[model samples]
Target: MSVDNISRADELVPSRYAVPVGDIEVLVISDGVLPITASTLATTTPPAELAGWLDDQFLPRDVVDWPLNVVVVRTEGRTILVDAGLGVEFPDFPRAGQTVARLEAAGIDPGAVTDVVLTHLHMDHIGGLLTEGLKARLRPDLQVHVASREAEFWEKPDFSHTVMPQPIPDVLRRTATQFLNDYRGQMRTFEAECEVAPGVLVSRTGGHTPGHSIVRLESCGERLTFAGDAVFAPGFDNPQWQNGFEHDPEEAARVRVNLLREVAATGEALVATHLPFPSVCHVATAGDVFRCVPAVWDY
Candidate 1:
């Protein structure tokens, strides 16, 4: 199939994946649709060839689920939402809009939000920031933090021309501009690892985005990391396998290799943006190999 055909196919299916993490209960809220197509999933492989490969691997018949898993973290005194799922409006997409609703379902109020730390400014990650009128959708007064490096990358003069899908850059530009204006002084950015809270820290993990970040939660000797799009699916047995959508596949592969090693060595439970619903998994290493063993949380 052609790339255009694959893009069309991806618009159909979407899945929501999440898991509860530590005292800071985290959920992977879904927004938008996820469709698996030859180009989006395995662009390098010929459409027919990739179809055969996926079939052999026992993946969905011809498509893999392309759901967006937005991470929401709930903490005491304040509710922290990692990435906002899509709002009710967008040109061509369906949203769960459950970020706040689900939070309410969990007994969380939108006004209770104290901080909203973004992993990056991608549409799926930041779209939940507002309603059509620019009103704060989730938590109006929430402090929205984005990585400085990422903010600077797309803001560059040549970034628009560099992006593969032009809409990706355009969306970021619109969202950031609006966020900067609406949130104003509430917007804060960091360059490297900084403790966002007593037990939560944000670490820079670029490659997927120029300034993509992952959140770390350390409490009562239990440490958990919310890896946003860094390790998509553990999709491949090789921990180093790179996804097709990565901004810099080589750099992304390297980051995953290192992360897998570190997570395994420390035996930390991680919540990934895309891993399968309730995406909490622990890393176990055997010699040079690392595996993601999904863990069942008591909560």
Candidate 2:
């Protein structure tokens, strides 16, 4: 079971990576990559500063390949999935929406998933809950947990925004409505924070979205945090930088800083959805700044 053949630099690396947390076993699966221009991150930062930072990190200044790492936790006889990736396909993001394929690659049967915990209702996070034709895709019996506010926000017709074009939001709302209606009995919502499974808790970390949250897993004294787009890697190290895609840049920045500090202090392993593939890492303080130290892959 050695993963010695897998390399991060490979264009098509293995879709699943194993993470050990005491007695619990966690699987990090790749949904796919989303290509975004580096300039779009921290839009307010000066171009010179941003370029210098990217240079220091040895990252391409023009564009970055943002990977989608969806976590699967198996504990207490339960199979729980965190954040469904983009459904079947996304025309705007050609490389995205490979969650289903990746899950199968990891030998996980979709029917075995007892719960789907959505970190937020963003298109990328919730899109995988339905088929391209806008039909529920997960097992009808599995419970789907989402933030109460997030579900409400998408149901309204006037939840307009400048982040995405008019058509995008419209489609999102439509699909959201369909999902809610199709799985009325299985859909559930929570407020603030609550334990969704035996050792999994969802805590609201609003800023990215009204009801956005990060999932916390604890078992046998080991802990892991599934940070759903709370922040990106390098830009987020400087908490002051604001992402252009954030619904509330100021609040998002505040939450990101707090989360980094908390993880650093508690020694919690973090899995950021938008970081590079196999996004499991630990946060640490480097002088006055925060840095991401990637976790070594375990077979």
Residue pairs clashing in model 1 are: 17-277, 18-278, 34-66
TM-score of 2: 0.87
Tell me the RMSD of model 1 versus the true structure. Answer: 6.6
Summarize candidate 2's per-residue lDDT along 1-299 as a digit string, tens digits: 11122223334667778887877789988888877778767688999999998898788999877788888988888889998887664667767777766675677877789888888776678767664432344466798888888777666744422254346666767777766786668877888887877878899888877888999989889999999989688644687787766777788888898999999999989998888878888888987679888888766
True-vs-predicted CA distance for residue 194, candidate 1, Å: 2.0
Predicted model with the maximum TM-score: 2
Model 2 clashing residue pairs (backbone): none
For each candidate in turn, the TM-score is 0.79, 0.87
* Local distance difference test values of all predictions, in order: 0.64, 0.77
lDDT of 1 at 17: 42
Give lDDT tens digits, candidate 1, residues 195-260: 767787889998787788989887767788888878875433555544655777667778787877
